[model samples]
Target: MARASPACWPAPACCNADFNEARLERYLVLAHAAGITPVVVLTKADQADPAPYVAAAQGLSQGMAVVALNAKSGDVAALAPWCRAGQTVVLLGSSGVGKSTLANSLSGGTLATGAVREDDAKGRHTTTARYLLPLPQGGWLIDTPGVRELQLTDVADGIDVLFADLIDLAADCRFRDCKHSVEPGCAVQAAIKAGRVDARRLDSWRKLTSEEVTNSQAMVAAKTRAAGKFTKKSAAKRRPN
Candidate 1:
């Protein structure tokens, strides 16, 4: 019968980038939109060269802080200030992005993590629930179940900050409503043609925008239906005042 008020906190406190740069875009987008001001601490540093990962993330995040974390070595404190008190943060990324591993590192203990088997491409999901663990100094770490598909929930306001090039180009488009696709005066397309914008980045932006629209629609529908169903009985039991 009623719409819930908007949440004022960032969620899932941990985010894993893995090999997907686009996913990081979504995560950072969500973080920035929530006013969380994320300091990205990347895990699984020993698995591969994290320099490229850092570079890729820097490209998406501009000046957002990013640190390569090897939890086993106890280097997670590099993200201390962000995780300090007076803040609630969420970790989001695909499975095996070391969400749990980093949590264990921050909390200082052995949390379960399934190693990637020699043959199978999937990893064992060790974190079955989302829980907040208090940091030794202060603050909390909220670890979540690794999601294969991160449907954009509340990050629409962050697209511009996360994808600044596209935003800047749109400002210069001849037509105010330029769609970036074959709209004659679309500056985004012009940038793409001139090698000023990476086609892949443009495509990623399109894909994320589409997914955000779809996810927003789906969430609204689901919430509306649930509200209707849950309140029907209440209406019948209502007493005249």
Candidate 2:
């Protein structure tokens, strides 16, 4: 789950303000949940100044590695640390973010790359499937198709760890289950008012937390139904029919 270098590639002409920060946060949470060291890699650095994007990505987590590089160039030495022997890295980003091109650069293989639309910068699905390739550096690379959406299920610990600062603040609240919304003595709300915490981040935390709970419950219900069906079939078989 280690987020290898290059999580995003800015648009060629200008910085894509439309880049989904929430989606990127979800990816980071997923990596943390899987116990992988997440690194944010900003690709297409040669086209524009990557300082802003780098800062934004770095702000996602304290001390998280953020690297900006021209993936089209064969020199990816900055990523060598994570691409070392015995390690495996995967590229996860939206379509047309140059995941395939980076994979080709890392593996020295000619992976099919698609051109982005001039009007929208959206890319076609050149890579329709996931492929595990051997990098010349002796590590492994998993190149996957662009992800439209990432669903979370049973990842409560990951969400808590990702939002550890908020979690810590919540511990000091008067009520153990304080929702932080209009709840008296809510430490989180106090921090937000004092400008210590970004209100948007708190919103992101609540969204992910609620989504995980809903999805986890759905998964449990599905599993229970499946088990009941299997049990009924076994009982019917035992009836000697």
Candidate 3:
């Protein structure tokens, strides 16, 4: 049930688009929905201030852990707790985000590195495959390639968990099925009007939820068509000449 997702958003017509931040938010929501603790690592902190990104990541979901590091030389002891005995950690990020560099640092492996383009800050795929390594502390590290396209299906649970505040606000809406778009007595819209909620956060929730429904429907339709084709083929095979 996979579909091709757009590489860039907002302005797909633009020559270069950076959708990493938005994708990161979606991933955080998915992680929370899946009951996995998310640790957001902002690499290349030495090159520039990671404060803004760290702040935004924290704002995505309550109690999400975020760390900024130079990956190449930063102290990784902060990540030690997640590497405790019998614990398995997975690193997910876009290409050139320093996942490999951090993985090498933590696991003591010389994973190759690549330089990001100066113009766009995009990097080549240095780590083409996934690797499992033993950490110095007593756990396992699974490093994967940076994802380019991620689609969500039936992800309302994840969105609900991440946007609990919004859900609570929606509970006070005038109607149980309020769409929050031009609807009367919409508490979510009221929160936006009162500056209590970021308009962008509400938009993200709507986008994810709508996309999930669309993806789910598409998947179901595809499966139904496939089953129909299979039935037709089976009937033909059973028909005697």
**Backbone N/Cα/C clashes per model:** 9, 1, 0
lDDT of 1 by residue, 89-133 (tens): 466666666777777777765668776544643456778898777
Across 159-180, the per-residue lDDT of candidate 2 in tens digits comes to 9877999999999999998999
At residue 117, give the lDDT of candidate 2: 88
Identify the superior model by TM-score, candidate 2 or candidate 3.
Answer: 2
Clashes, model 1: 9
- Candidate 3: the clashing residue pairs are none
**Model 1 vs truth, CA RMSD:** 5.0
Ranking by lDDT: 2, 3, 1
The parts of candidate 1 lying over 4 Å away from their true place are 1-18, 222-241
Question: 150-213, model 3: which lDDT tens digit per residue?
Answer: 8988677888888899999999999999989899999999999999888998888888888989
Best by lDDT: 2
Q: Lowest summed-lDDT stretch of 10 residues in model 3?
A: 6-15
Candidate-wise lDDT, in order? 0.68, 0.79, 0.74
Clashing pairs for model 1 are: 11-90, 12-90, 12-91, 13-89, 13-90, 13-91, 14-90, 14-91, 14-92
Tell me how candidate 1 scores on lDDT: 0.68
